[model samples]
Target: MAQQRDPRGSRALKELGDRGLYWFDNTLARGAAALVGWLALLCLAVVVPVSTVLVWTDPAVPASAPARLAAVWRLTGETLRLGGKTGPPLRMTMSVLLALVALLYVSLLVGLITTAITDRLTELRRGRSTVLERGHVVVLGWSEQIHTVVAELVAANADRRAVVVVLADRDKTAMEEALATRVGPLGRTRLICRSGPTTDPALLSLTNPATAGAVLVLPHDEPGADAEVVRTLLALRTLLAHREGGREARPCVVAAIRDDRFRLAATLAAGPDGVVLESDTVSARMVVQAAGRPGLSHVHRELLDFAGDEFHVVAEPALAGRTFGEVLLAYATSSVVGLVRGGTPLLAPPPDTAVRADDRILVISRDDDAVRLEDCADAVEVAAMAAGRVVPERAERVLMLGWNRRAPLMIGHLRRSTLPGSAVDVVAAGAVGIDRSDLADGPRSGLLVTVHEGDATRPEALHRLDVGSYDSVIVLGRDPAPGDPAGEPDNDTLVTLLLLRQWEESAGRALPVVAELADDRNRVLAPTGPHADVIAHGKTIGLIMTQICRNRHLTPVFDELLRADGNAVRLRPAADYVRLDQETSFATVVAAARRRGQCAIGYRDHAAVHRGLGHGLRVNPPKTERRTWSALDEVVVIGA
Candidate 1:
C-alpha cells in the first residue's frame, strides 16, 4: 500500500464484516419479521449516509460540522416525509434526484408494512388464534351431520343465549357460508367457525374444550372416519389433561363411531364420563324397526328432535311413593314414560311399581322447562275398562328394494321381529349377491331373505313383484353416486314409492312402504304417499348424537329401546289396549296396557296411518282426553 497498512486491523475488520453479513442473512431468512426488519435496516443505513454526504457536498450547505450534521438530519426527515426543513433548496437537477431517492425508500417501507399486515390478517382468517370462551358447545370436525347438529342445538337453546364454536379442517369463511345456507337464522345462538385440523392438540385447545359445556365429535364422511374420531378424542384428552384445572375440568365428550367393532375402543378413549355411539348399528336397527312397524321412524324423529317433544329426566318429588300408573296422570302437560333409579332407566315399568324419592321420571314435553307435575287427579277421567285383545304374530311376506351395507343387519333384525315362514324379496338394479351363510341365522329364526336382480325403479320390474302382495315394502337408500356422494338417493326411492302407490290404487289395497332417505330435506321434496314412511338417515343419526351430547344417560335407554331383544317401542293394535268403536280416556288405555304388561305412550289413528297424516300419530296425550278408537288404530306402546 501507499503507507504500510496494519494487516491485523484490516483482517479484524474483514472478520467483523463477515460475521455481520452472516447474521443479516440468517435474520432475513427467519420469516416476515426478519424481512421487515432487514428492509428497515437497509433503508436507514442508505438514507442516513447518503443524506449526510449530500448535505456536506451540496452548494447550498452549512459550513460548520455541527451545522452540516443538523442539515443531514433535516434532509433525512424531509426525504422520508417525517417533517423538517433542510438548508436552502437545491438546484433543479439535485432536487429531482433527491426526490426520486426519497420516493424509492418510501415505497419500499410502505410495501413491507402492507405485506406484514396482509399476512397477519390471513393467519387470523385461517383460525390460528386461540378462542377465549367458556361454557360454549364445541363441535369438532365437519360433515353433513354438522348442519343438523348445529340446527338442533340452536333450537334447543332458543330461549337462552348460547355459543357453538365449530373447529374443522375447512376455510373459516367457507364454513360460515355453508352454515348460513343450510341453517338459516340461529336466533339467540351465536355460531363461531374456526379453520384447522380438529385432531391437532393446538387446534383442540383453540376450541377451549376444557371450559366447554359439551363437546360433540362428528365423524368425517370418508374412509376410516372412526379412526379419525378416535384420534380426535385422544387429542382432546391430551388437551384436557394439560388444562389448569386438570381432569375434573374436562367437558363432557360425545362422539359417534361408524363401526361397532371400534365402539369399545372409542368408549374407553372417551373416558368414564364420555359417550360413544355405534351409528351403523343404530341406523341398521332403526331400518329394521321401521320396516317392521310403519310410522315408528316418525315417532323416533319426534322424540329425538328439538323442534318437537323430547325426552327429559326430571325428579318429581310430588309423585314419590306413588305407583307409576297413578303418577302418569299427575302431569297434565308432560307424559311420564319411564323411571330412572340408580342411573338405570326403567321404561314402561310395572303400573303398581312405587316411584322412589330419588327416582327421576323420564318425561316427554316440548321443553325441559315445560315439564311440570300438577294435581290433576280431578282432571283425569278414568273410563270403564273394556275387553282387550292381543294381536297374534303371524308369518307375512315382505318386499325390499335397493341394497347397501346395512342390508344384512336389517335382515337379521327383520328375522327377530317377524314370525316363521316370513318371506323377504330384495330387488335391486345390480346383480348384488348376499352370502347365504351370512343370512343363515335369519332363516332359522323364520325369516327368509332372497335377493333378485332387477331395477326396482322401473315399472316392469316393480310390477313383477306384485307390490300389494307383501305386508310391508322397504325401499332402502342405494349407495351414493361416485361423482356426488352427498346427493340424495331419494330420486330412485321416490320413483319406487310412486310406483308402489300406483299399484296400491289399482289393486284397491294399501301397502305399508317404509322408504330410507339420504337427506331430510328430500323428505319434503318427495311426493307424499298414504303408505310411505321416510326415514332420513343422516338427520336421524344427527338427532341421536345431539340428544346424547345433551344427556349421556339416554344412550343406554335408547340402546335398550333399539335392540332386537328386550322391551321395544311397538305400534300394536289399539284393540290390544282398549275396546274399539268405544270412547275411552287415555287413563283407561294406560291401565289396559299395564294389565297386559305393556306401557301405552300414545296411539296412531287408523285414518292417519292410511292417509299418511303423521300429525295423527299423537304421543303423550292428556290422561283426560277421550276419543273413540278404531279397530285399525294402533296403540303406541313400550313392550317386550
Candidate 2:
C-alpha cells in the first residue's frame, strides 16, 4: 500500500523543485547544495573583506563605526562570560579573520579559472584530432561502390596503416555516419571525410594526394564520372606537377575508364603507372570471355581481388642484363612472371631471351606478395619449351554467325587479333544497326560491318553467309528489351550455333564455333563439342560482381586482364600433365611463362578429375617448386 506523505516535507520539496532544486532526491540535492554553498562562500570571500576594508579605511569611518565596534565588544564580553576569548580579542582576532578571508578568495579564483581552461582545451583536442599516414590510399567519390572500395582498402592495408580518405561533395558527417552504420566498424584504417567537389584539388589535398601512397579517382554517379575522373586526374596531375601544398610527391594514381578513348588520355595524363578502369568495356569483355571460356571469370576474380594472392611488379636483379628465357630458368623455382623493365613490359618471353636492369619484374605468388624466394626453377622452362608442342598459328577467314549486345565488343577484341582486311559478316535476323554514332563502334577502320537480314536459326539463312568460307564464327546473344519478361538471348545464340554446325559438317571440316550463352544450363547445346567454345553471360557477371565486392581496386586488374596485348592475361597449353605429381607448383608454371614473357598464375586442365569444381581452376601453388608436373597441366600466363 502507498503511504501518505508529510505535508511539510512535500511543501519543502515543491518549493525546492520550483526553484530547479531537487533536494528531495538526496544524491542530486547534495551535489547541488554543495555547489551552491561553495559559490556562496566564494561570494563571501569577495564581499566580506571589501566591506570590512571600506569601513576600516574611511576618514568618516565614524561614530557609527565606534558604536558598532562597541556593540561587538559588548557581544564579545557576553561571550567572555562564556569564556570565548580574553579582553574581547580585538587586535589579534580581527587580523586573523581578515587574512583568512583573503586566502580563501585567492584559492577559489585560481581553482575556478584552472578548471575552465583545462576543460576547454580538452574539448578542442577531442574534437579535431586525426592522423593520416604515408602510403595510405584515398578514394574520391560516393556511390554504392564506395562501400566495396572501403572494405577492400581495409583488407589491403592490414599490414600497414591503410587509411581510406573519402572526398565527396556530400555531407562529411553523413558519409561517416553511413559508413559506421553499414560496415559496423573497421580497424587500422581511419576514414577521413572531406567536403567539396571531387574535381577540386584543394579538397583532394585533404586526401593529401601528393603525400598519399596512391589515389583512386572513382567515377561519379552521373554519366559524366568518366569526364570527372579525367578532370580529377587533371587536378591530381596539377597537384603532382606543382611544388606547392605539400602534396607528398604524388604517389600512384588509378582511375576508372568509362570510354576507351579517354582511357588512353588518362593514362598519358596520370603517368606510366597510372591505371584506367574501363567499366563497361571490361564488363562486356568478361561476358564475351566467359562465353568462350566457361568459369574464366572466377579465375579473373581470384587473381584480381585483394583477399587472395596476385601479380605484382617486383624487381628482378638477377634477370637484369639477361635473356628473357634465360631469366625465366635462372629463377626457375620462382616465376619471373613479366618484365616491367624501364616501363617496357616484355612479359612471358620466348626461350633464349634477355632481361635488363631497371625492370620491375612482374611475378605471381600466393598471399599478398610477402613471401621471399631463394631460387627459381626457370632453367627447366627452356628445356620444357623444347619438348612442348607449339600452338600453330593459323590464318583463316572468320565469319560472324550472329550479332547482338556483345557484337561490337567481339568485333573490337577481334580487331586486335584479326588480320588486316579480314572479312567479318554480321548475320542478324533484324535490321542490324551499324551506325558510327553508337559508342560500340570499333575505333579501327576497314573492318566490314555488313548486316544480312534473315532467320539465322534456319539452315537456308545460315547457308546465305557461306559459313564454310569462314574458319571461325562468333555468335552473339540478342539484346532484351526492358518490357520483355521472357526474352532468351542465349537460346537464340544456341539455335544459330545448331544451324552453323550443319554447314561445318557439310563442308567436311569443323569450324570453330564461339557462341555466347546467357545461361550455363544451355552450355551443352553446342554439338561441335570441344571445337566450339560456349561463353556463359551469367557466370561472368557473378564473378565480376563478386570480385569487385572482394576488392574493388581490381577494376584495373580486369582492365589489363581483358586487353589483347601489353601485359595481358592469356590461356596457353601446359607443358606437361599433372598425373606424375600431386603437388604442382605455380612457380613451375610461372617459370615457364617467364621464359616466354608470360605470367602463369593459374591453370585449367581438362584431364583433372575434378575439372568443373570451384570454377574449374584457381591455382595458388605452394612456395617450393621441386615437384614434377604431368601432361594435363594447362599454363595460364599474363604478359605482352
Candidate 3:
C-alpha cells in the first residue's frame, strides 16, 4: 500500500526520468546520425502539439476530428519545411519528397564551403604557405640571437618598406608574439614567420630564398647546433641547385657555428658566396681585446649596431687614381677606413697605395646616403697637429675570475698580444690546465700563467686575490656541465659579478673589467664598476653576422680589425694626435694621425664617460666640428 502511494509513485517516475535522460545523452554521443534522429523527433514532438492546439483553438476550424487532424498535419509540415499539401496522398508524398531533396542539397553545399574554408585556414596556421616577397631577408632558423639579428635588420631598413621572413621549426603565432615582445615594433619593416624544419629542402624553398637579397642561417643554442646549421646549409644548397636559375639564383649566405671543428664543413657547404664565422673564437678574441682596452667594447657597440655609425662600401669613380692618403681627406662627413678591390677589403693599407678604378672604399658613416665628396683638406690646421711619437710596450698584469672551454683560447690570444714578463692570474675552482711551458713554448714568451683553486663566486676567494691589483680582470661564466641539458651557467656568473662588485668597492678604485655573458638578456643584471664591460657572446656574433650579410666584402675588414696580430681599432691619448687644452677641428686630428701612418675616425671625451651617454664615445664625427681638446680626451684611430 505504501509503494502505491503518491510519494512512492513520484519517486519511481523521477528515477525513470533520470534513466531516460542518461540514455538520450549516450545516444547523442554515439554519432551525428543518432544526433540528427533525436533532433528530428524533438522538433516533431514540440511542433505537432503546438500545431494541434492552434487548430483546435481556432473558431473557423472544421468541427470534424479528421479535418482538424488534417489541418494540424498541414501546419506541422509547413512549419518543418517538409510539405503542406491538402488534397491527394500521392501528391502530398511527391511534395514532401521534393522538399526533402531540396533541403539535402542546401545542406551539402553549406558543408562543402565550410570544409574548404576550414582546410585553407588550417594550412595557413601550419605556416606552409609560400612567401611571395622579393628582395626580402630570409632567416633560416631560430636561436638566442634571433631577436638581436631581427632588431638590427629592422633598424637597417628603417627608411624602406622591407620584409623579413623567418623559417623555423616553431609555431608561427608563438614566434610572432615572441619577436613582438622582445624586438618591439619593427617600424616600416614587416616580419613573416613560417613553421618547418629548416633542414628540409621542400620546406626551405617555401621561404623563396632564390629571390631573397640575403639568407642568414642562425645556429640553435644547443649541443649539436653546429651540426644542425651544417645540414640546413646543405639542404639550402640542394634546393637552390634544383631551382629555375640554379646556382645563379642563390643569394648571399651568412652563417655562424659555435664549434670550430664544424666551421670548415659549414664553409664548404655554404659554397663560394657564403661567409662562415666561428663564434667562439670571435668572442674569445673580443673579450681579450676588451680586457686589454677598457672602453673598446663601447666603440665596437657603436661600430657593429645599425643605430650608430657602421661600415659602408661606396664607389668613387672620380677619385679612382688618387692615392689612399689623398682619398682620406676626400669627405668631411664620412671617414674612410679601407678600400675594397676585386671584392677584397684592404683595411688600413699603406697610404701610398693607389685606389683602383674597380675599387670601392669602405667608410664609417651614419647611413648609406650619397656622398657629396667635399674636401676637408682646407680645414686641416697643421699648427695644432702634434708630432708622432712611438710609445714603447710595457709588461702588465691580468686577473681572470672564472673558467670555461674558451679559457685556453683567451689565454693564447693574450699571449700573442701581451708584452714579455706580463702575468695572468686565473682564480677559479678547477685547474687552469694551461701550462707554463705552453707560454714558454710560444714564439713570444709573454703572459706568465698562474692558476689558484677557489670558487670565484665566493667572496672569501675573491678577497684573497686582492681583487683590484691587476691592470684588468676578466670574468667568465662557469661552463655547462657535460651532458646536463637544462643547466643555466649564467646564475653562477651573476653571483660572481655581485661579489666582484663588492670587492671592487672595498678596494677604493676602479678596475678595468671585462665579463663574458652567455645570455644577452642577463647583461642588465651584471654588477660592475663604471669602467666595466659585459660581453654577451651570442650578441657579438649575431651583430657581426648581420653586418656580413649586408656586405660580403667586410669579411676581411673585420678579420684584420678584430684580430691581435693585424691593424686594429685603438684609443690613444688625444695629446698624441692634437694639441691638448686648445680648440681644434677634427681635420687637424685626421692630419695628425695621417702623419703617424694611422686613420683617425672619432674621439672620446673622458669628462662625459660616466654620464650615461654611450660612455662618451663618438665615431665618424664631422671634420668641421671643433672643440676644446682636454688632456683626458682620447682619439679613436686605426693603426698597427
Candidate 4:
C-alpha cells in the first residue's frame, strides 16, 4: 500500500502559525517582483524606438529594410497633419517611422512618471502606515503636531539611526509640504508618508506593523477623536488577535484620545501595549503647573522636547538590587525619579524603594545621561540643586480663560500642588462636563473649583472673567462634541484668544497665559509678548503620542517629568553654551547645560520664533549647526 500522502496540510499549519507575516512576505516579494518586472518591461520597450530608427534610417540591405518595415507596418505613423507636402515613399516612411518612435518614447516617459506619482497619490489618500523596520517609529496622523514630533524623535534618536513614518488621509504632497515647512529643518531624520485614516482596517495593513518598534496615533480635529481612537483600537486588536506565531508583536501603539470616556474605551478595546493620551488632561495639568511655577512650562519643554532632559529608561544594573533612594544618591550625573516594571511606571515614588532587575530607571539629564550613570549624591543637597525638594513660597491664583473636558483634571492636579490653597477658576461659554466632587480637599479643607460662565470670545465677557486676578490664564479650546464639523472648535478658540488679547491691551496688563490651541494655522495670530503662551494642543499630544509609540517604556519617564516640583518647561537662549571657537558639536550644548547645573538637549532655531509659530519650534538642528548655539536660539528644558 502506498502510504496515503496527506495533502494541503503544510501551508495550512504554517498559515495558522503566522498568517500576517506570511502575507507580508508574499506581498513584499510580489511588489518587488512586479517592480523589477515593470522596469525590465520598460527597458525592453526602449528597444522598439531604437530598432525603428535603425531599420528606417540606417540603409540596411534593401531586403532587410523591407523585412523590418513589414514587421513594423502593422501600425500607421499618422496624426492630424499640418499643411505640408508629402515626402517620397522612403522619406515619408522614414518620417512616419521617426514620428512613431517619438510617440512611443514620449508615452513611456509619461507612463513611468504617471505611475510613480499615482502610486504615491494612492497612499496619501489613506492616512495610517507602519514602517516594517526595527527601532523605527510609525506616526499615524497628519497635522501641525507632526512637525514637533519628528523634530524631537530626530534628536532622541541622534545616537542611533531612526526612521519616522507618517500615515494620514492627506496626499503625499500635502504631507511633504507639512514636513518641508514644519519639520524638515530638524536634524537628520528619515521620514516616510502614507495615506489612509488610521481607523480603517484595510488601510492599516500599509503600515506593516509587524516589524515596527513603535506606533503613534495623533489626536484628530473631529469631535469624536476619542471614538475614532476606539475604532483604531478595534482595528489594531483585530490585527493583533489573529494569533501570529514565531514573531512576537513588540510594536507599541500609542494613540491620543481627547476625552476620558473614550480613553477608557480605548484601553478596554486595546491592551496595555495600546496607550491612549488624553490631551486635555495633560494640557490642563501642564498649564496649571506652569501657572503655579513661572518657568515650569519651560521645564516641561526641556523634558518633553528633544532639546533638554528628555526622559528615558536607563538600566541601573549595578543598582538593580539596591533601593531607589540609595541609587538616586549614588548613581551618575542624572536623577533617578521613578521606575517602570513590566511596562507600568511609577512616577516619582518614595526614594527608599527597592529596585528590581526588570525596572526601568526614570532619569532626567542630557540624552547621554540615559546611556550612562556616573555617581551618587546626597538626596537633600541634590534636591536643593535640582528642584521641588522644597515647596515655593509664592501662591499662584490661576484663571482658566477657556474650557474643555480636561479643565477639571487640570484643576485637580493644580490643587494637588501648592496652588490648591489659592483660587482656581474656569471661564468658558459652554458647560464643562465633569463632577467637581471627585476633586481633593484643599488647605481650607475644600478645593476651590470656580466656574465663570461667559463667552470668552467677547472682550467684555473675557474681562468679566478677571484675567488679571490670576498669575496665569489657561485657555482651552472647546472640544467638538462627537461628530461635529471639523475646525469649528479651532475657530472658536482663536476668536476667544483674540478677545483675551484685546482685553489685555485695553487694561494695559500682561498676565501669563498658557493656551491650548486647536489649529496650528492660528499661530501667526498667537500673542508672543511676555506672559503669552500658546500651545498647539493637538501637536503636543501628537509629539507625546509619537514618543510613547516609539518607546513604550518612556511613558513613565514623561509621567515623572510632569509630576516633579521643579518641573518646568524651558527654552534657554541657544547662544549661552556653544562657543563659536569650539569645533562643531551637539556635545558642547550638553556640556554647557551641565555647567549651568541644567540639561542641554537640542536647539530651536530663529525661524520658528520669527512668526510666533509656537509649537512649530523645531528642536535638534542637524550637526551642521552643532558647533555653537546662538542667543536668538533656545534649548528646551525642565528646571528652575
Q: Which candidate has the highest TM-score of all?
A: 3
> What does candidate 3's lDDT look like per residue over 357-416, in tens digits?
999988999987835598999999999977666678888799988888788788888888
In model 1, the worst 10-residue window by lDDT is 84-93
Question: Candidate 2's error at 256, in angstroms?
Answer: 2.5
Local distance difference test, each candidate: 0.80, 0.58, 0.86, 0.61
Candidate 4 lDDT over residue span 127-177, tens digit each:
443356656677776544667777778777777667777777778667877
For each candidate in turn, the TM-score is 0.82, 0.55, 0.90, 0.60
Query: Model 1, 1-640: lDDT tens per residue?
Result: 4789899999999999999999878887899888867776888799999998899789888688878887887778776654555545554346556766787798899999999999999988887777788899999998768999999999989899999999999999899999999999999999988889988898778888888989999988777789999999988888888885465457778898887778888887788899888777788788777774777887888788888888899987877899987877777777777899999999888788999999999888887788877745565334555566555768988888988767777787878777788888888777466565666753258777777899888899986777767888888767665445564566788888778777877887767778887778787766545556788777888898888888888988888888776778888888676667888688777777777767677888868755755547898887778898887788887768
Q: Which stretches of candidate 4 lie over 4 Å from their true place?
A: 1-135, 185-188, 243-250, 319-326, 329-332, 339-360, 369-397, 411-426, 429-445, 448-453, 456-468, 480-512, 520-525, 528-533, 560-640
| Residue 301 displacement in candidate 2 (angstroms) | 2.7
Error of 2 at 154 (Å): 2.0
Global Cα lDDT for candidate 3: 0.86
Regions more than 4 Å wrong, model 3: 1-25, 53-64, 84-101, 245-249, 387-389, 429-445, 479-489
Q: Which candidate should be chosen as best, given lDDT against the real structure?
A: 3
TM-score of 4: 0.60
